[model samples]
Target chain A: MIPVLGGSGPVIPSFGSGSSCEQNNGWWCTDWLREHWGDTLQPALVQHIELVAIAIAAGFLIASVLAIAGFRYRLLDVPVGGFADFLYTIPSIALFQLLVPFTGLTVLTVEIALTSYTLFVLYRNMVAGLRGVPEDALEAARGMGLTRVQTFFRVELPLASPAVLAGLRIATVSTVSIATVAAFVVPKGLGEPIFIGLDQNLFKTEILAAGGLAILLALAADVALAWFARAVTPWSRA
Target chain B: MSVLADQFTAHTFVDAFRFIGDNASLMLSKTGQTCELAFAALGIALALALPLGLWLGHRHRGLFLALGVSTLGRALPIIVLIAFGLTVLGVGFWNNTAALVVLGIPPILTNAYFAVDGADRDAVEAARGMGLTERQVLLRIELPLGLPLIVAGVRISAVFVIASATIAAIAGGGGLGDIIVNQASYGLAGVIAGSLCVSAVALLTALALGLVHRAVSRSTTARA
Candidate 1:
């Protein structure tokens, strides 16, 4: 049966449940889902997750370094962040199309586009978090004769943990949802079934059902990321 | 290749500018398309959200949960919604616009909710005591007071909606996305031209929203 919070469904479990797009012949919305997507589903899900995971990892790492650079240089903040915002507005599909000539339309295009998105949200949030760090905390850390790197790791990072985590939360959830859109380019993942259903237009129930699952996936990722943030940084909590 | 790379960058800039100059009609059409979407969505959001915001902000029902939910809406990437919409609505301008509107709603809702509701309750009571109708209270009192925050939210929403609308171009609804996507097939000049046009429109829309926001807020301040 389809798992749902309400009776509403787009059963996520059966990503590759059936071939019949029409004639509820082999595909009951419930039956299609009950079949358990098995091997086909698992690899698709893994690849989707990997694409997002790598992109977010790259984004966070690059942004953290750039944030530090922004803090040090200040000028880098405006131009770099502005550029990120510009990239943020570029349609991911359009960007993917742009990259195809060079990269040949693979996971790289998806990763780059998704990763670029994380930069805008993460850069803005991380910068805000770093700026919001209590000034006196840093003063005390510096007074202890800590080197710049040591001070950043020990003082700046710890105190700024909440904002950074908030950034990560935004980044993670956005990554989860945006990752599915990568299906437009890649053949694998939860999105493929939904797109596949659309391409065939055989099963409205199938497409809607699969799509509903992706939405649920997005919501779950958002909630989990928020919880992860709370767990990582207790000081930011109520 | 190295020498050509530098020339390409400069050449792309020139070509991009020329595209804007040549295809100003297309640029304007896409810009208008985006504007229409953002403004219509903002108006719809305000109609639903303003009153609810007043209640949430003023009443003590633990609005954090609601605010948190709206934040989640914001965090959900725009493209996911687009993909989902394309599947359900089967792709077109209206479907994409509808998706953008859904994406646009939460920010305005949360902002209006917070701004209007956060008004001084004592002031609300006084207005009521002075025989103000609910309409008067909202119009003459709470709304005027909350207008700044509400407008700020709209501004924020406008910025995002404009950006999201560009991606909506992939739906082939005839916006800047048309230019950007056709870049490769259309020639290098076309690609450079399209991207610059999209960026320019996105930036200009943001700037125009900011101006309108400032003007309205200023008028409110002057009236006060």
Candidate 2:
């Protein structure tokens, strides 16, 4: 099991290698990466993924409830949106630090901050998608003796899938990027190496590796989500 | 100095407010530095993105590039960008400023481009029919029409720069982040105070620019 905060050992252990790249502080040290890939880099990547997954999952659940309620009662839309906008305006770093007094320096603090960031994008898109469902389609469903629940499931949701999936794409990509900052609060995710490298005399190799992996992960998630959206909404392709 | 130290030891919200009060000068200076860095970057970003966005948008070209830049910008984390800057540019004001300028560019550029490109084609044609040169049409017509979105773009970038500027302190750049990051010296109350200040600056910037956006759009619509 991955060690939690204050207990996790030094992120980058000193290898004390006599290699030329290590001595010269080269930007991309292949030798160092090959040596620490499993013990260091891989775990950081896994932790980063876990942070993003948990935050997005939690954010999606909350945003869905908010979106549905806002859609049912249009009056709640302004206040709910205003709250999300308020959350979005706060920087990730500041939000994390602000939570520390309440949640302490734990993964929960990091996740709470990360989850809040996702709500604006996710809730906006979900509501827009639901509202964008054609009125005629809803009417047809009603004429066919479909109940409100059935009409929503069979008609509204599928119609709104494109916008909702688009929101997920954006929320996922951004959450991946923001999750790196969570390291400043909890010593987990790709940010750990980036911060550790900064603290450890600006270890060039570790910083580059971790930062590069984060960018790659975001791009990959974006592409995968785009593809998934297409695959799920086959009718939209036509 | 001893009194300041005692205030820094604050733990509760009231104590945090006291810390801000005692360190009023320090807080003010840090807040000013944050504004300086944020505005400097925003200025540079506007100068660079506005003209380019305007030109491309006027010609109805480079849609792909405009959208791609914003998408790429969104995907790249500001912290990682700052780390990269530290490696190449070394730690200083310019390093932080440059990273922030990159952060600010995409939104402004995308909005500017769209703002111009999406201006009413019929109005544009009508202007052209009245013997306006392409430059005149662009400057007189598209720019006014797109002003709202451009302002909105600036509003977004301003908020981003102010918020991200807090992290510049980690790279030896002076800002409110200094108090927050050096928790051992400033204490938890100081850190909270700094965090509150950063959020306040960011929210205020957004609010101010939001007013600008509304005003610009309102004036433009009234003109129409």
Candidate 3:
């Protein structure tokens, strides 16, 4: 996702990522991070959160719309689903390069990429969620003289809520991990810290430390998401 | 036909041939590299994770957690692992292969654990009541019962590992990904050739695994 478009570098959130303390404070890659690890943590964590938040918000809304359309009309499923599959097949790096011209390497670019990813897994889950509504329930709602819209809101959505939440949890964890790549283009977040560590080609220990932290963040996200999933669905025990 | 269209069509075909000719030797070695990485990782995954998985299934029934955790590997993309591994351990085949193994482990481990745990609990009890030791029960009843699931998981893991191993080639892991990346700069021919290499490895491994799965599953099914 190296920036190749016309404009500023990646659309990282408001955070100072470009400055290097190596020269000013002789932090080098290694000790610089150690000396000011707290300084790096805020920006990286912020960037990470921003990337994930943007991605999930966009993805779920779009996926929900698509799911509704698909549920209403079966014919739209193949064409739209096929296209989503196509997006999923293309490597993340290649897709980013192609979009750089339009999105200009910002949070928007990363958001779109991460959102597209969520589609592959989340769309299926969304379909499953919607399809899971019992037909008898729908018929009962119909017999009660409820409109299609009302049935969907009351009978369908509530029944599908757990499945949708499960899908959201999966999408959340997936987005958090995938969002790391946004740092390849953008200027903010933990990715920048890790990328800078990789790029400067200095501070081996410091880079390793960053790497360890990234993995830790990844594990933490997994646990938190698992907790969230369990909270939403008491039946889905590990 | 317009000469431009004809020439373009001819160019695509010729480019395809030339790409294959140019990378024939490189393709073979690269294929070997990917195969070696996939197979070795499969072996290691089986050795390290399979027994543990089976044990978890049999003992306190912790395999479910193993299955849940392994799902993490599947959720994350292999490309990211390749990228991260390159930075962490410099760039080379060993590191790439190691990363592939790490990526490959979850599926195999999950399958092994579940298959063993899901083995006919009745038969397991029968074997136990017959005065069989835990090890004997596992070796004779559990292993044989769980063989199908374990094999199926291995097959799936093998295919995934092979496909993923291509990305490792980017970091000089010496596989089809090298071809994919190499010819990618060359245009359509490079893309086709590299794609072919990846597809070949994936499909071939998948087919082999399928055969293995069928044999193992059939035996287990017959026993049941």
Candidate 4:
């Protein structure tokens, strides 16, 4: 086990040499990273990515199903959007507390909340994309004797790809961000380092490194997603 | 029943009310503090983002910049920003507010830029042709045309800031979150009470702004 940090014993601040090293190092140092990477930093980063990946994947799946349902039944859009917005309005901390008793401090609790957060972004974008498909294109597909399913898969889906890609990028970024707070619920990810940094008064280096890494992760993921979007939607350039 | 008996023996709503009543002063101050943090952030973000976005959109430049910023801002998590703020600036109002200000900026900037960029081109050209200076054209035409989306952006930021301000308590800046965060000592009733207040405030703020957004867009559409 990679030391959960808080369940038992007093928090032993073992990573760094001392405050003097931090002060001398000034904010972020390569030396400090080398010192901690094998044990603390790498694991936290991996876990952070894992949490974000799982939540976003799960969220995208659920949102896709819901979005399709809403699109198929126009009346479902209102209630679906409203419910997602309601879930979005709930403060993250409160949501965690509300779930902790029932879920008892599990990753499932974090995933549920994180997944719920993605629905509004994903569903709205998906619906909008589907709706925004040019009517002429749909008509042409029908004129070509394509069935509704064929028209949808060939004409509508390709047209909707850009919007869906945009939604996926948004959902991924937001999930990465929110998963940081999941440390409070379960001591897993960069959040663990953050809380430990705050609690242990290991202020400068630890928090900076952890927080900076999280930001970097987000930026990197975003850039990658944007690149992927462009590559996948080659027609968008024209 | 005696006052003490009544106070001790209470249901969830009664306990919630008692928690509110007992900490009435703290709740009020914290609520104000949270509002100040959120509003201050919105104010600063508006000051910085609006003009830049408007100018870029007016000149038909910086589309890439605007897009990059919106994407980047979404990627940066609120909690990490808060942690970074605390590390860089120490635990204070500035630290908490800085994080929130960053949070509020992208939507306002992106919307403002797109609003100007997407304004009716013919109206803008006509205004310019009819002896209006660039500044005047922007002020008289683009600004009005863009007002609906700009306000919608602010509304989004405001609601987001209000909801995220609860994290300020964790950062040691007092807010309604203080109640929920301190639920260890304040108990389950305090959590329920504080959460209700946060949710209500978030929903109410969003609802009010939503109404304003609709009115602005509706009037603009009517004019068009």
Candidate 2 C-alpha lDDT tens digits along B191-215: 7788788878878888888787788
For candidate 4 chain B, the 10 contiguous residues with the lowest summed lDDT are: B1-10
* Candidate 2 chain A: worst-modelled 10 consecutive residues by lDDT: A13-22
Per-residue lDDT tens digits of candidate 4, residues B1-224? 00000122247657877888898887777777777887888899989999999999999899999998887777777887887787678889999889999999999999999999999999999998899999988887998888888887887777677778887788898888887777666766676678777767777877887788788667767875
Report residue A11 deviation for candidate 1 (angstroms).
Answer: 35
Query: Which pairs in model 4 have colliding backbones?
Result: none
Residue B124 C-alpha lDDT in model 3: 90
Q: List the residue pairs that clash in candidate 1.
A: A10-A209, B53-B113, B57-B117, B58-B117
Residue-by-residue lDDT tens digits, candidate 1, B1-224: 00011123456667767877887887788667766765676566666665566666656454775576576665555655665576557667667777777777777778877777777788889999999987778777787777778777776676667666766755555666665656544455665566666566667767786788778778877886
- The positional error of residue A224 in candidate 4, measured at the CA in angstroms, is 1.7
Q: What is candidate 4's lDDT per residue for A133-214, written digit by digit as tens?
A: 9999999999999998999899999999999999998888877877887887788888888887776654567777887788
Candidate number of the best lDDT: 2
Candidate 3 per-residue C-alpha lDDT over A1-238 given as tens digits, one digit per residue, 9 for 90 to 100:
6665887665774334534653342333555656666787666776677777788888889999998898789999888776665555444533443345456656676778888988866777787888888889989999999998899898898778778877777677656665655665576655566556555543344445554555566567667766776776675443
Off by over 4 Å in 4: A1-25, B1-28, B214-224
lDDT of 3: 0.68
Query: Higher DockQ: candidate 3 or 4?
Result: 4
Query: How do the residues B87-181 of candidate 3 rate in per-residue lDDT, one tens digit apiece?
Result: 56768766777777887788778887787778888999999999999998888898887787887677657766765676565567766565454
Index of the highest-DockQ prediction: 2
The DockQ score of candidate 3 comes to 0.13
For all candidates, what are the clash counts? 4, 0, 9, 0
